[model samples]
Target: MKTKNNIRVGISIGDINGIGGEITLKAFEDSRMLEFCTPVIFASNKVIAFQKKHFGLEVNYNGVHEASQAVEGKVNIVNISKNAPKIEFGKETEEAGKYAFLSLKVAVEALKNNEVDVLVTAPINKHNIQSEEFRFPGHTDYLAKELNGEALMFMVTEDLKVGLMTDHIAVKDVSENITRNLILKKAAKIHDSLIRDFRIRKPKIAVLGINPHSGDNGVIGTEDDTVLKPAVAELFEKGIMAFGPYSADSFFGSDSYKKFDAVLAAYHDQGLIPFKTLSFGKGVNYTAGLDKVRTSPDHGTAYEIAGKGVADYQSFKEAVFTAIQIYRNREEYEELTSNPLKKASGNNR
Candidate 1:
């Protein structure tokens, strides 16, 4: 809820057995997060108790039943879980997945009801969450489906933004998925998001090819020449700054990616591999083209170092700050366009 200045952010506690709780505690360790916005963690008191003892960190926690009752002085938690499941650090269990799903569901619902301005998610284990109750591939898919299937996962650093044409698919199947319509749609979405969210008017996008050397002019493959080139050309005609059916081999090596605002990778690893290599711990995995603003750490749920108190909080901190920035930008844009007096205060000419 916004009261002229403060924005309330809903945080979903990710897998308890992973580094979700650990990094969450560490991320908000700074007092600056509370100054700009209030965070309500959709978790339980028992989960907090477990994390504090397991990580050997002392954090002042306040239990609140509703969003309005939350206090900015401490970490305000909504006690959603009645009985915290037996949490074993560094272990992936069905129970952990269930709680993670529950926390996210509560957070999403709160965001939908206008109780929160943005959603900041921690990491979750896909293997553990592939059960009867939770069948989504990951948080992006779940949020997309919940928000009427209008979201795409885009990874972002200060310098780079990477959007996947097809994520979480086998390398062999990636070729078939590179169609003209899909490419055009994702490219348009990326362009729109750059203008609306990132505030970039003429966002340049680099489209990577599916084959080596961009199909070597059809000698190696034809998808790059037939599908990618035509798709890019069509977007160009529409006045979008779309470039290249670039060869994946040389595109990232020469730092050619620095020329574009974002890269539309043909597949998952195509973009993420290089992105993670460049900005692994500092990057933010943002869900673009969504009706609601959402962001997560680029890394996954590190179950190995779950309760070790060694989980780095850099990415998580970045995600929260990014969400807050996007939310504020959106709010400002709305206010600027909606107020006729404010709009006229600038040059009418």
Candidate 2:
């Protein structure tokens, strides 16, 4: 497939009414983003203007109704709306949710149409984005359902890479969702993603035990032995390099996580607690296994700090860079796979 551009990135404005727009503008303040790829914003010019004015950001916007009008030096807006909702910092009204959802929809459509190479989403409010039209717990679940259930949420930091077997679920109901199929599926997605996106030839994945001490041989909890163990065994049979039903507590302390490319957790807090503690302001939330690349900051819409212009862009920066790296790696992988290798010349010599 011949793309019109080398790498056109589609950025979705998560919640214009919140700090999503501010940090997005801050991210674009680094003009070097143009060096990597063309970026198109799936947001209304009005929203961008409000954010720029409200937060005193200096970035310029060029309203483009389509991707064809995208150009460097200015933030290219797809102009999903000309007269969208006004800026109301820290608000979670339905209008904000609707706008955020529309932005994501446009970005996803652009990716599907090959108009963009990768996607980097800003933080969005889960409760506000869960209405009749945009009823989803979070971006991960929303994207997974939209992409025919192909995405898995993975938290990535410089030190730790974690995957939640279940994301955005109730703490009480986590055990009910911990079936062998679910565990294996999340593991397979993470494994394939490590190889295909991260370029890991052989991914070593660690599966965390749902109970303490990995159930102490079924003395603490049977799920760790019966459910997690069976899934790990199945993954091993499929030639996937995976291990454990490890005690979550010791898994991180022993520096055992250093040995694997990624760790699979049974639930949301199981994985995120450690990840966030280590990288509260710098973690990248990546949705792996999607046909197109997508990433976001691990944090949410900081309503308290809205319009303060103090929100750190480190996570956002990491996400954008990570997305670019993944896109390039996948592109390279496809190129190599499609071409044939040459035979050695030693015999002829």
| lDDT, candidate 2, 133-224, per-residue tens | 66778887777776654879999875678998988889889888899999888999999888788877788999999888989998987998
Estimate the lDDT of model 2: 0.83
Model 1 misplaced stretches (Cα beyond 4 Å): 1-5, 339-349
Task: Using lDDT, give the best candidate's number.
Answer: 1
Residue-level lDDT tens digits of model 1 in 1-349: 2563367778999888888888988766666667777778999988888787777776777898866677765678988878888888889888888898889988998888877779999999988877665687788888887875467779998899999999877888999987999999899989988877887758999999888899999999899999999999999999888999899888888999999999999999989999998896999999998889999999998877777788999999999889988887777667767887885774374
Clashing pairs in 1: none
Clashing pairs in 2: none
Q: Which ten residues in a row have the lowest lDDT in candidate 2?
A: 340-349
Estimate the TM-score of every prediction.
0.94, 0.93
Top TM-score model: 1
